[model samples]
Target chain A: MNGKYWVPAVISVALMLGACGSTKERNPAGGTVPTQTSEPYTDRIAPAPAPVDGSYDAAAAAERALSTNIIYFDFDDSTIKPEYQGVIDAFASYLNANPTARVRLEGHADERGTREYNVGLGERRANAVQSALLAKGVSAQQISVISYGEERPADPGHDEAAWAKNRRVQIIRQ
Target chain B: MKSIRYWTALLLLAAFPAAHAELEITVTGGAEAPLPIAIVPFSQVPDVQLDIAQVVENDLVRSGRFRALPRRDMLQRPNTPAQVDAATWRAQGIDNVVVGQVARSDTGYFARFFLIDSISGQQIMGYDVPARSIDQMRYVAHQIADLIYEKLLGQPGYFNTKIAYVSATGLSHQRTFQLIVADSDGENPRVVATSREPLMSPAWSPDRKQLAYVGYERGRSAVYLHTLATGEVKRLVSERGINGSPVFSPDGRYLALTLSFENNPDIYIIDLRSGTRRRLTDHYGIDTEPAWSPDGTKIAFTSDRGGQPQIYEIGIEGGDPRRLTFQGRQNLRPSYSPDGRSLVLVNLEGGRYRIGLLDLATGDMRLLSDGPLDESPSFAPGGAVVIYATQGARGAELATVSVDGRVRQSLRQASGDVREPAWSPLIR
Candidate 1:
């Protein structure tokens, strides 16, 4: 916590750390520093910049919720099982239907990774859903996301059946 | 008073070197050869009939830094400071020596002890502590180890503290959760709460007077704060969406929690004094497990802001968030060491969740816990150890590993499965 680290506290500074994701802003001792100032950050991973339609259609919006556990992933990920296009699509449509209605996406994990890592993973899952919904024409103003860090497991058991259920993205109303 | 004399000795020891006013954890660097030392039983008040010497020796050994000398090999056990013969231990290949005695008080008892450099024949450090002030003899022993640790390692010792964790045990087919508190060494487990439903996230207040955690009852999860003295409990957060993951700042002024009441799950800080809440993260993505650094300037939380469930750091008030973890395909539940210098996190490797420590400096990571499943890693306030949920032989149980992965112990009762283990701050 103290800014000075080169003295007697060398080992502890090394305890709570591991390698970081983006290495652009590395510290002198190699710790990563913050980049974006926004709260609900949406990483700009240029996918040819999807065209902005600026149109709202209730039926056309992505499915707001799904009874299934199928989610989608951008590349290689077991988190938020990516094929959730339908769920994202439904949420997009719901957002278009009611702009005033605020909805939140709760991200979750499969109990496979560290709980804290899964929290960020869950957040990433929720963020991915939010971004995907935005691409399908969902307004950012009405949607929010939070990661539970594997604290709220949909399935409490330790087996695979439970892990699949634990790795999820629940949509909640504000 | 003997205890007061020990306090003065501690103060003098602090003035010499290796004492910290603020509690700090001393993490051992990479796998180095362990240090060899000896702690000879100190003399005590006549007829007191308590030997806390072995207890002090045990704590130091658990640090993974010291190799304690067996009590049977001791050539002598001295009570008075002048009686300590550093040469005797040095001849036995012991590097350090500790000796002490006990004094009786109107209420209970008082004790004084010291650590010496056996090789140099120098008075490394010495202090006296009130045994009566310490209802638990283990804490008094921890103080002895802390003095020796400070004299040698120069970091704040966390031996004289406790950890709060949930223990579960039942029919292998049935599940239950029980909130239990025990010594850092996994001794004296006393249940504070019990139920068939699951209990998660055992967090300690800054003062260590209260604990905040989430419990499941009647099929719903709610956050509750339990007082150790009164056993009185109150709900801090319980809403329509999941309301959980409560962590306290160093100052114990506020608690950062995950709440879905605002539609999307966002991170919020609740004032324990007034019940006022402040929202810190607003991303459409999930943000949970907000851990405060020792200084309380920034919060290290698990967020997928980038696109994966990676770790990120955000300001307490609000501002830009910087990504922290990137090594494994999956990482989360980053708990800061007491000094906020390093983080103990659960990392997913080869399809297993293991405990790992991230050096805030160097961006390098090292695997600490070896297991198929690990979660909810909570750091000791000093950052020397971490307690988290793990899948043991039976079911879910609470396990601990020193930051260096040298010392490991698991706390399991007949309850059912222990999920979250939070280390309490030093208060008493």
Candidate 2:
């Protein structure tokens, strides 16, 4: 079961490097680029950046993708949203390239439900991300998962906007 | 430097309030009109610091079943039965009158009180209570209130019991969590545990000598049992995956908790003395929040096996799980009432989460709270009231509602969020 994931992990690392090199060549002045790409791998194989307007800068877009660590989820669900999958893929590539790299996934939920059950939901979310990374050839030993439930919130407001930010899995590099 | 800062923060929290600030309660709803009553100022040879009559009055008022007459309305102060003028109280439309006196005794402060029927002009009940110190005087008042409640309402009073809750202050990264135990009326709040990470799911042992809760001290969820008298904390489980929702059995012999070491959350029971764990649920779906039935024969918990979160019950020895809830979008956090006939849980309905009570026999559920975001419904000792956490204007505050859902009161802190209220069992 464990051996099946190593091949994709190696391929994702190659894809990660290729994408980074391509972005640098396209924009020398370090400007932001449109997140979307027309390549076929963008849809099925790898996390494709979102489509943006012509005014988008390539360099800034690349930096934002690389720096973004938090992955948000839908209400009461653990499946990684399509938009956030790219963020998880970036971390997976970084960890696969540097085998010794370690990161901690801290899962959180909003203050809408019971605390303990939210903890379980948070764990499921974190584990979902961990599974994605592991499938990308990131060693299980290099990653850890912890669920903070609704105890920690990125936005403390009780409204939907705040709750959307609170139900997230934060990837912290160790 | 980090250790120093942590200790400094701990010291600041300790210094801020060794005892919990009295929770300001506001009664919002009630089914029946409150009975008019007066608690006369307790006469003392040398007046004590504690206001025994006021504490009793607050307890009665918070119950939403009694209307304590204003002290100014009392025509005269009476300390004994002989001094009581029932006709005067009856003229004032008072139904009952309580009069007491505090006197220094050989062991401690001795308190003697009498409950009088204003209309009948007869003493209904009388008792003498002893307190070791001024701090206990508050508890003495609670005891008196309990007696009065039982006599008039025919239900056990929760005033003399204690409550455990999690208090969070600050924001996000700098948030501080304190596991606090306070009197039922929100007095004498003591910090039993503190951590920069979250501490939650506080369940009092049957004996009230310890608390079993989940803490994130090591950056991962772990179940911990904290002994109150000795200040001793023992970590019961800290495995690779989740270790959350540790609740003691009715007999206090075992702790039912959730662990996901196998990559799926499941319910497990751990014997406290032998340290043996028995897995109860082996399903792939999430199985957590294990609440023991009052008889200890069955365990009710929240599970998502039915496609959405719902309450389910299984025997102690483990068997086919029976689904217990179906009316809401999701149902979670099931806590059995003392009688074991019904359970209270958080039910998501119409996009708003509220507290719901489920009848075990008939499988009928009733929504008991009207708040938008109410959670963690725990039954008071006698099943007369259910205390839960509700989101208020300032932050999350504690609220209590009667079983009939007519009477409601909110216990708000001065600042910070106070939640996860677990009412202690009746303390003799």
Candidate 3:
């Protein structure tokens, strides 16, 4: 059993080292190094750390893991982009680790379509994120979704930049 | 994008009082040649509150049909038939002359007016309107305008009608919303509902006494019925998921709305008397924005079952829906005309949304608005013009255009975005 687990563990460590080295070169302007080294290193030798009561706040964990809270989409599309996968993965992991964690996904859309139809599009975007979390082993009870559509726009302008910013899903801890 | 902030600041300066923001109207397009008329200022007693003649003149001028002659150009200020000099008005090329007066009565103020045909010097019509209070003078002025409109233009007048819309303020997170009711001319605005959460989709009942709208009071969407007379609100529907896009049937017996409790947004109708809901569409894709036909036999809605949003019609008894639009890339938010012969909807073409009028009998669609983003197309009581929400320099504003696309007018609020305009039926 030890040998079977060691092979995959070694491969994961090698991948992490490669990722860490590339990130350092790409962002060499005094940016702090990615600080998620505790999990992989400890999982290889010791049992997983038990979740602490009252200390595991899903919101703080999310803030530390991701640089931004907004996940954007293409025009009239709700599919999650590959660039946002890491952010979502971090959130899903945090949710799975803490059984009491709960989140509300507020979805929105650009003001290009009709209001009612945009409401439907916004809901679809939020549900897309919810499905991703569910597939990552997060319980349905931990997630609730609401769509504001184009009603509450982050940037209230009539241009491409504003439209891009408005079409996003914001994850809020409950 | 920088211009938006500047425009917003300018609008904020003009916005105040929180409860009511009188909209300023700008007429962009109208008849090629407006019929010139003279609306002499009404002579009033000391106690009367409002400028009744000015209100009447503004209504006729905004209608895009009649042009009131400048008071400076008028040769005389006539308040009765005896003071009228028809030859002088005809010499100035005026077609009609309006004269009026407001005097005090035992109960309240009384107004008498007359419309004269300039060529014949004959009184075409006249009335003695009584006002119960000073505040009702504006409404009395609108009634006089409606009478003149119907007499000269040969069509039903919509001047005395009311409009319901949603007004929003504040930034993204700290937003406040209000459902407001105002006159068609953007006067006498009253806040019917206010919430920290989002409020949208205000639909008036047939009697014009109740409004059905979607509110997020419980952290999730639910439909609420608000009685205008009593200021009473009751939650009509609150399921697990979305409850939005509430529209009343013609007879006020049912409400068609969109519900997503089963994880799919579909059209559902609730019997107002029985409180029973019946699902209208079972499609996996979205089906929302239900509009009842004038006869209450069919319902028009927006659906994406065909891969893109388009208008579809389904019978009230429930059956297969027939697609009503195929030309636009996407079509939604359909509202039936008062005559039930056509529909006005938001059509997406070339990535820009505009209001389009689709005639059911001829299958011909006419683009009625020139704005890039126009939505919530609702027909006026007379079906001669459509009022819709459009994006302006300062944010969303209300605009109206004739069905022939000739006359256009924009209603601009001082602050916040005013949207989802629903024109009420002619008040009894």
Candidate 4:
């Protein structure tokens, strides 16, 4: 099937969502502007100043970023929040540096709306991460995505606190 | 049109024995003036195990259409039409009476019941149904109830139908998901398929012989078709992205499903015999949960094309979608009523998700459930009630409400999260 027939429409839609995403990024009064962009994400995962064995530990740096494997999302929104950019940068850098390493992005949503629609939302969230990694020059073959929708939730509670945690994309190393 | 199924070239797996899960039901509200009737306990041989009259009474009462006269109020229990005391029933304010008996036969057991119009003192109808074994007696009870329901209500009964749903047990990583099939009342639960990953979106085939569901394996998701009688499983589709929301066409010739194979979710139809597929919706926004019209010429699905999720209907040949719901802030999962007069859906109103019905002719919607979180509404075969999943005290459980927004019921399992309920069409 020529899925490209709808590319023009998809791009316009993506542009609209992108605009919304940036609008959501603006801080309201009294809200703290996240310091994610103030510091280089790599610096947080930089190698140790002086290793006991005098050897560089690349895995340690990657581990710092990979440790927070889950990227959370706003309610009913698949656009990646600025705060999760650090986690995405670490995974992207690691995947780009090691083309052989594979990862499966498991996307999830809160128990809201219908189940099947959440599956689509989950896929969109995973695809967002996939697009981020591709932008960092990671091989597409090293990444796969699956949407668990509302089936798998990080927190099984019904409140907003749980919903915030449930709306996430988990990066699982394979 | 209904397609006839031939059992040729099918695989049978005898190992999938049925496992039972107890479902507790609580009914509330009823018809304004329910038909007053009496269901006398069926005379039966020893060791029948189930009370046939009680099951029938429960079914009628659950419909909110009949108020069964309690046995304690009856002067006598009649085992046949000839034995029914019409004058006594009339005095009891019961216009109709049901009488039946079960007896052992050379092959197995036979149950017969008669419906007598107490006012006229005449037999209206009667049926003799055979049960090959004791275990089949419950099913026979449901069949008898269906017969009585249709005879009295002038429509097909869903009492004899089955309900397919996804049940999740355990917690967190230890969670186990099962695709279960149970009687309409949520009894006789059988695990059609089980997985450690996750199972969702279980849909019943038109003929009621198979179920299509989404299951995950090895961290990847796929759609599967499961043959109930045979326990044989077939992986229907597993595209690169989301492969889910599979629903059978009314004629069973094709399946309308949601696929994100092109990197975005959209509705697609797959030809079962040829394995060829054609895209139905090319929306950039999510277009999923496709439900077929009873005649199979149109499909109604949930979409976010207008910024908020709403139900949309499109022709099978692919065309501009028409939005069908605007009353709610959001609506998803569009399941059509059997008569095609209305669509039962999950409507989001006042920040709460509830089951709502949209009248196709009047273009009006009304809430059917009072909910903080209620979803996945499916209509019964006769379109009398809508079954949906709601968050209960323990976890998610199944519940039902009459189409008129009167009767309500909660079908809860002893343990586990039961959801994604799809009511089967009447098999016969």
Candidate 5:
């Protein structure tokens, strides 16, 4: 086009561009345009299944069910408490009944020690739990232990109450 | 006035920085307690913008040998060593005075500091270190403290050194892994590298020019050496399986690393100058955590080759390895003491993973640190203290403990969990 006509042609092209946008272009709201890089994610939240009305009559009849997962130790110590032997026994019975079950003993520590020391400490805590379980007729093959080593705390607040709860080995069933 | 001479001596003592520095000093081998010191204030810098003097005071106090003067108790702050009226400070019982001035520099500022004896006004130590920016001002302050600590204590200060650590924020599923470098106090944390996958194991080059670390990039693991002075990075090993735990030998000639090219992890030494590699271990079990001895002749590593993880020492040249740890059921991450006489290992004893110093001389091991889950003990170059990773709630973090088990302190920063603190070798 001639220089004088070029201006009008440019204006027409600009008008056309203003009217249409590429599919890859996005809105100003930070919402992504549909693109190959974008993966579709589900937005619908589903309710969990309704609970059955049946009761465990035999298990509910048992007196004072003990939580056998956690066991505490003294500072810098991995020795299992004598008073907690009954809980270990109950856990041992449950583990024996469920033969295919695998368990992970997680060890944790209070903030009193160094992190590496705690890793070792956590490992020892888990090791002690594993040994106790093995001593109670549980197969080593059925048990797997990982010392989170204070990496994962059961209670996270920085206080004695939190520490007391953290310094324990937890038996997790998998 | 009763006696101007008496008043003058008292006034001289009061004005001196050494007045607070006179507390009991514990020599490493001695049974004496650390000297109590009063680090009476250096004049506060209004625009200088950092608690510079306070940091010096804290370093001296934290060493366990110099008990620092509590800030609340200073009767008067004499501006300079010359103006220090020793008599008043002697009356208050502070033994030393530290004085400094921070002046603006081209980029940031220059800080000049001096330690002076309260009675004589004689300077014990003085230094002028440039802080390139406000970010480095804090580090420069620590450098000055190191000068003071070394002048007074004869031992090298760990303050000027940088600690390499792995910092992770966010939950486990959405976590970010970053290899970070910061002051030994964990200040001014900056990321060296970041990744969605785990970044583990950091080691310092003996020259302090570069840092070697494990990087998990693009579903592959490799060891990388990053130049701090030049911002250059090089990948040393990116083979199949695990390529991690790179440690530089004392002479800076070779790097001992753990690689799994053959479907198993074993210790391997690479000539940094030639890029040639030689395998150090040939066992079926795991052989990891290789730490070079101070003399660079032998490497101390953790191997389950003995049926359980134990500290073992093998010559750099191929030979039969000798196991160093026999007491612990499992011991990993064995770090050699700089003196070449001791190895600090993660000792699993009564169920706690405490830092244990194994005296190579006596073949005796004592669990030095208390609390739980302590692993990965790295020695301070002078073999005075240890810095290691321990479990904090939520994730792994770092804390330090002295060799004598007396001075234990955490790097009390609010940054997300930090782990694997490898102390850099002396830069100067």
Candidate 6:
């Protein structure tokens, strides 16, 4: 049993490292399935396309995505959905290239549960994103996390659409 | 520079009486057969603006125990027990009657009220409460209600109490949070503190002199102890991570709070006098929203260790935590009733978050509030009512429900969303 577990763990680690180094699997179509490793722990967010020329502005590319810089989650969950990997990839790569650039991950929850518990939930969401960014090799110094619980809402409506928008981690560039 | 400007503006706003947004309370539900009582419009000597008798009537009606007979229905306006005609009120099916008179003296004012049982034709209780000014008459009225409540029902009345809550306005970065303390009837709202950042979890000191609450400074959570009399705030705890849920122990010497610095969020108790701390729980799951039992020997808290958030009780000396709530999808924010036999908490069932009362001995849970979203349950001083936060038509607002789950009232403000209501202990 020990040998069986060890063989799969080693293979999974190898696949994760390969997925991190090779750029061919980048999800260009913007779908839920991330093109990187399927493993939840070491899944690398595929960064934005590599700059081709000297005039290419990585800051400009990140700015456009950061304009609507939001990553949403399911009800009462902190697992960064696969669809938000592209947004996280843009943030991680931009922060990695620009070490001086700092961002605050403001996590929020919908007004469903108790307030303090939502604060914990929000922190978990922010920490989840922070882990994702760190797994992609973004410097820890460039990222900070704060959870606003259900105090701040992207949409104040009581329906699921508003709650879905509110359960989010906002990447705020500072 | 922006932070400085915001602090300066907050100080200026706190220095004076900010917007007076009185809570408009509407009784939504009440007992099936309420005791019919008549509160005659009190006769005034100098004709004061504040109606002391009306205030008392509103207080009693809101409790759902008493149904105040309208002034129009009164056959006579009696100002004293001597003037009360028991036969007339008894004929009208009013079992009891409250009559009062407010007289202005050279010093200030004197309000005298009489609670008489029409069935017995005897005065139940009477009191002459002095008010320094007209502004204090409402408080005097609440005192009268409390006396009558205790005399009639044999339970301490919560009328002469206060509630501290967070009122938030604006959206996003422009949001302004004000910690407001108002009378139990939602009158005399005074802004205790203002913050550009979010403020939550207002806990009342046992003496009712100070409040310990969670406020964010520079986008990080910190707990502060604010002296109500001096308007001075002491930053009590600002650990590296998650310093929130500041609840005062029954004796007021310690504060049971949740700090995440060690790792994940866990319950801890801080010796307020010594400024020292001790860890209570070491769970990886979120362990927060701690409440001290009235005896201060045990603490009840919300923890998700059982795969979902539920109420758990543990000894103050750190022992095996016993799970207290087994019903609902989740139960959070456990607050012991003053009697310490039960806990009032936010119970989520069938996707609807409502206020729930849990019996400690039987482990039976009963849903209280009818809610799509109702949270933050705190028992009133007497444990007769539980004031919680619920989503109102305008936005979030403060509400109260009797422990029996009969009386329901919605306290709404003209503006801002109100949440996290902490009912204060009875003022001596």
TM-score of 4: 0.88
Error of 5 at B72 (Å): 3.4
- Give the poorly placed runs of model 5, Cα more than 4 Å off: A1-174, B1-32, B44-46, B104-109, B119-121, B132-135, B393-395, B412-415
Candidate 1's TM-score: 0.68
lDDT of 3 by residue, A1-174 (tens): 134444555665666666655563444445466545434332232233333333324445455774456899888898999999887898888788788989889989999988888888899999999999899999999999988888888898899999999999998877
Off by over 4 Å in 6: A1-68, B1-13, B16-18, B104-107
List model 4 lDDT by residue over B1-428, tens digit each.
12223211212223555756767889999989989999999999997979999999998898888999988888999898889889999998998999999989888998999999999999989988999899989988899889888888897778988888888898898988878888888788887777777788999888999899887766667888887876667888978888899999998989999999896899999999999999999989999999999988899999999999999999999889999998979999999999999999999988899999999999999899988799999899988889999999988999999888899899888889899899998876
* TM-score ranking from best candidate downward: 4, 6, 2, 3, 1, 5
Better of 4 and 5 by TM-score: 4
Native-interface RMSD of candidate 1: 5.6
User: Model 6 over residues B257-294: C-alpha lDDT tens digits?
Assistant: 98887868999999999999999998999999999999
lDDT of 5 at B245: 72
**Model 1 lDDT, residue B140, Cα:** 73
Model 2: runs farther than 4 Å from truth?
A1-65, B1-22
Runs of candidate 4 exceeding 4 Å displacement: A1-59, B1-14
Better of 2 and 5 by lDDT: 2
Interface RMSDs of all predictions?
5.6, 0.9, 1.0, 0.8, 6.9, 1.0
Q: In DockQ terms, which candidate is top? A: 4
Candidate 3 — which residues are off by over 4 angstroms?
A1-63, A66-69, B1-20
Q: What is the lDDT of residue B3 in candidate 3?
A: 29
Error of 2 at B164 (Å): 1.4
Q: Candidate 6 on A21-119: residue-level lDDT in tens?
A: 754445444677655556444435654434334223434455565566889999888998888888988888788878899999998999899989998
Ranking by DockQ: 4, 2, 6, 3, 1, 5
Model 3: how many Å of interface RMSD? 1.0
* Docking quality tier of model 1: incorrect
lDDT on C-alpha atoms for all candidate structures: 0.67, 0.85, 0.85, 0.86, 0.69, 0.86
- Compared with the real two-chain complex, what DockQ does model 5 have? 0.05
> Each prediction's Cα RMSD?
24.0, 11.3, 11.2, 14.8, 20.9, 13.4
DockQ per candidate: 0.17, 0.58, 0.47, 0.59, 0.05, 0.49
